[model samples]
Target: MVSQPMPLLNGEPHVGVFIKTASHQVVEVLGAAGLAFGVIDGEHAPIDRSVLDTMLLAGYACRLPLLVRVADGSGPAISSVLDMGAAGIVVPHVDCPEYARQVVAHAKFAGGRRGLSTSPRYAGYGSMSMHEAVCSGDETAVICQIEDPEGVQNAQLIAQVEGVDALFIGPLDLAHSLGADSVREPVVREACEHIARAACGAGKAAAIFLSDPSDKAYYQELGVTLFIIGSDQSMMRQGTRALSSA
Candidate 1:
């Protein structure tokens, strides 16, 4: 069977949150909360393959499209997550067209380097034939994170790469790469706009992490259609603080 399409592929202003906790309950809760999607923070979090497997199961059980942010973004790393039935992958430090191409190559099965396997959950436990698996696997989203100045400079070309679903801006990393004090710095803001423009120009989704929901309008005007508002940890902390104050 062909896999379900990503919400981002619709080119709408979809909001999601990062899932840093390894608990399946967190995945279930986020799905219940009406978030458009969720990203498992495998990059920074201590979530290993076993933990990810359980999380993906919870996601599928709850009908939540959960993407995984890989730590290294290598071929094996990309393939492993997709094989586990992750909705997609968020590969970081995709600073150039070649690297962007590699990320797509690793995630796609047709005309790509991704190894074949019908035993994985993505293949419905051998229910899908090779052809069907290829088609369904290729539908997995391949989001490239543009975190460096070099990535911003190459955003136009990177966004044009086929099989790339979205250009995700890692705001903190981008700001750090530019030696800026904050994402609000003039230079950082300009770079973010440039990346969004490039992605929009190429008919791809432009995504970014936002600390404040109020800033959504500003980025939306710049052609950003996908917003990762905050992590589960941050939201929990905010809720706890608000409860204390009240």
Candidate 2:
């Protein structure tokens, strides 16, 4: 079995779109549009297992890496998405190094207690050997979200955690945690810069959610390489409004 390449590991800036709708067409359209990946918004959206399975299938058909932002960081929650073949798992509100470590434990099998099963879709329905399955599981990207002030304070240690591939900054939550009026507040920006620096120091990928595409340059300068910008629904709404105005 040939190993699949992880796009985020390619040393190029990867742009990903968030998917909140249950439509498979969104996945195909985004993939065709040259987006590097899709982040299924299970954290805020009402995405159940049935919908998630369909979206995962759509991602497979489009050859698009789909990372699921689990509603909460739990062993069962992380294991379920990995078993269903999510390219990676994005755990929310990882406040400390221990929490980041726990996220890795739940997503990866090496020194992890993630329940194993060869019959899952990711295992090729038992076509793969146990070793192959374990290897693949180990490769699954584990991203931890640093949303709170505590998370920002512990960002360096969190980035240093083994098996934690990336650090994702939650702009809005970070702003709220800093008592800022908006994500663009200078305080929030400083915190983001600090987190980005920590991630870079640890040689880990740094990611953020930016609604405005123009903000990409600013974050990129701070050593962030992964940008999750806008959702399918937002894109459709903006496109429709632009067409109507035109």
Candidate 3:
């Protein structure tokens, strides 16, 4: 993280679904419609170089921030996303500050020295000057997930990590880890609030997954701005239900 003050750009807080399949056209269409960002599913979905390139192109054209949610944080793929020109990254299953530090290292080119690659999709395929590209990297976002019990315990330290932009809470995973159902569970809700408060205390943004539209504004009121409220799959399921009824 650069000690030098850098202007962080927070795009609209969006709620989106876990895009589990690689469909470039669908990814492009949904983003164009509206979604502050899309977490390209590197964790559960089949995302390859070609699909990711297309998705990144779509996000770039729409001016929507695109993030890759890595199933495992800090490895080969995380480095690839930064190099591919993703707006930022969301590392899932982060358990501590050590994990957060690794996330920053892989996402940033400053101290991490993530090998300079020009003529890459992220660098506009050699359109951007090497110096300029490196500079943009400094402002790139790095979101870490706090899902497991250990992660929630260390949520503050994780958020306090220098380059961490947000601490996202995976309600379901967290609830499961705590031996409770995720959706509409009182235990999960409390845990979510706990993580949010710690993130607020640590001076990092709090991101949560919200499934219902009515609940979206509530979290924003609670000072949680980054919300993944719905997903493409859920929307499709809702639509299919309507269609079947009709």
Best by lDDT: 1
In lDDT terms, how accurate is model 3?
0.74
Question: TM-score of each candidate?
Answer: 0.97, 0.96, 0.90
Best-to-worst order by lDDT is 1, 2, 3
Residue-wise C-alpha lDDT for candidate 3, range 1-246, written one tens digit per residue: 111121223534555556656776777777677666677778877778778877767666666667778767755767777776777778888898987898788777888746676666666667777787677665677888888889988888888999889888788788789899555788778878888888888778888887777777767766787877667778888999999999
For model 1, where is the 10-residue window of minimal lDDT?
1-10
Best model number under TM-score: 1
Q: Write the per-residue lDDT of candidate 2 for residues 1-246, one digit (tens) a residue.
A: 222236885557999988998777778888788889989998998889988988887788778889999998998889888888888988999999988888888887769988888888888888889898998877888999999999999999999999989999889889988899998889999999999999999999999999999999999988899999988989999999999999
lDDT of 2 at 97: 94
Q: Report the C-alpha lDDT of model 1 over 14-76, residue by residue, as the tens digit.
A: 999999999999999999998889999999999989989999988888888989999966889
Give the 10-residue window scoring lowest on summed lDDT in candidate 2.
Answer: 1-10
Cα TM-score of candidate 2 = 0.96
For model 1, the local distance difference test gives 0.91
Those runs of model 2 whose alpha carbons end farther than 4 Å from true positions after fitting are 1-5
Ten residues in a row with the worst lDDT in model 3? 1-10
